[model samples]
Target: MESQPESHLLKLRKDTKENVRKIYNLDKPGRLEEAIKILQHWIQKQDHILKKDWNADYLDKTLIASKGSVEKAKKQIDRLCTMKTLIPKFFEVINVKKELPTILDLAMVMPLPTQTEEYYRVILVKIDTKEIKPEFFMMYFQYCLSVAEYIKTHDYANGFILVYDCRELNLAEVITKISTVELQQFITLLIEGYGARLKGIHIVSESKAIEMLINIVKQFLSEKVGNRIHVQRSIEDLPKVVPKGILPVEYGGNEKSIKELQEEWLEAITSEEHMEHLKVMYKACTDETRRNAGKFNEEYMGMPGSFRNLSVD
Candidate 1:
């Protein structure tokens, strides 16, 4: 993989020896090994759908994120694999430079260089309706998956701090451009299928658009996720919850501006090396055989009515 600035990679607040033991059950003589064995057994049952070389590290992270529950880890892995194949529009073969350059500009998704004191990775999102094209929602979904893929290997442990700058977009544009169903799909994928720990979400918007967005989010997200939401009236108010030092200059922080960070990401994701890496990550371990097994739900294949039945499960 191409190297990023040291800051872009996840940095733990402290040594995680105790957390590793607790989350992965490494202290128990056989618990860690048993978890691996269980995942391996489950993989084999899928007819070699998961790559033969799927490493212990990947399964270990899944196990850790599932809070050491083998059953939950199994479900997480299955959901991820099935969704990748089931919804190829988002996961199949993403050529962002060609397919989504416009939507990427409209909804800028990138990680902050600094993490919280508790080691949570901070993700920044700013949606500008002025730049939005008609296909913004689907493209934004692709951008989100790109962000999730980047963090999956890097920031799986400490969870995430999601910061949304809602000032640029208003209620009218939001309600029309970003439908309730589309929002539900995005939230469902992040919370359930992605398997990342979500620490909290902060929405900074002076207008009442914050309430509108929050109400829509509350419809699909669980109380656990809903309660973690912190609404701020303005960008200045963010410092009280998220220290300014960890934010970019665009958000009144000391770091680089959000535009600069977005440009850096744009160049990186469009580059030849990063594009190849994304292709591998997208296609790897996708189980077409499992899909053909006739056990998956076809109704949950794509957006529209697909998300109506999905909760934080």
Candidate 2:
């Protein structure tokens, strides 16, 4: 018999008409309600949470990312709440007014206007190392967190396809300049707490030096995620993996240019509403009383020792 098509692996369906919850297994009509009840019980049982840091949308995102697994979503939220105090270097409060302009100038994270047939949102990362400074690293990470949060709230259950454009980058310099601890922290959160599926990572216009970069990155990521990293030697070859229609004109697609995409994202992420939401997110993380109540184990509080061991300065 011929093997099933790979597209079957990405297939999703509506779990319930009332809730609009999508999942690969649609047999459970009450999955969303059951997951929400489980999360609500966990929230009430906790001693902290002076302001109720989360809402239904937050729970929905966590549940959807966990594929309707209440146990997994609970663990995810626990890690998320504990992460801010545990990793202040990356998860602490960021002053958007002071940081947003520089972040926009140095890096552009543009989510493609359309999703793929599998409903995966495409995100393009355009970095200009020439404009980046030491302080901009954390800002860049904060911007990424903002983007992830937006997707979690707005996109329902969709995963992501990340394209890293390294066309004009000084590969060696950029890699060495990044902090190992911070990089590990970011990767840990992406894998553990972000509550969104990272479908694939596509590296385009890469240099010969990318092998070293990949080796270092794979140390922090699992074999499964490592396998998902695709290196395209030339822009012309991107369509073999990423469809041409989703790419920008420079990459043989009809979407907006990098500059236009950058400006659009800058406006979206810096709007008054988004800025306030970011501030609230930071405040929720910094609540010491709330975090103290969780009482996470030393090893489980932040980056696992195994992950730390993978970090090379």
Q: Give TM-scores for every candidate, taking all chains together and pairing residue i with residue i.
A: 0.82, 0.82
Tens digits of per-residue lDDT, candidate 2, 1-313, equal 1111222111233322123354534237776666787788787776544335477767876776777678888778766765665565565445444556776666788887655766666888977665435667778888788776655545543577888888777677767787766777788777788765778898875677788888888888889988899888777887887888878888899877877766665665567766777667755553444444325434363465343332212
In candidate 2, what residue range of length 10 has the lowest lDDT sum? 1-10
lDDT against the true structure, each candidate: 0.68, 0.67
Task: Name the top lDDT candidate.
Answer: 1
Clashes of 2: 0
- lDDT by residue for model 1 over 1-313, one digit each (tens)? 1222332444454544345556456658777778888888887777626555556767777777787888888778766665665455676456676877777656888787666656567888888764444477787888778767766655545567888887777655666677665566566667667776778899877776667767777878778888899887788888888878878886778988887888877765666765676677676555454444334445244433453344321
Give the C-alpha miss distance for residue 87 in model 2, angstroms: 2.2
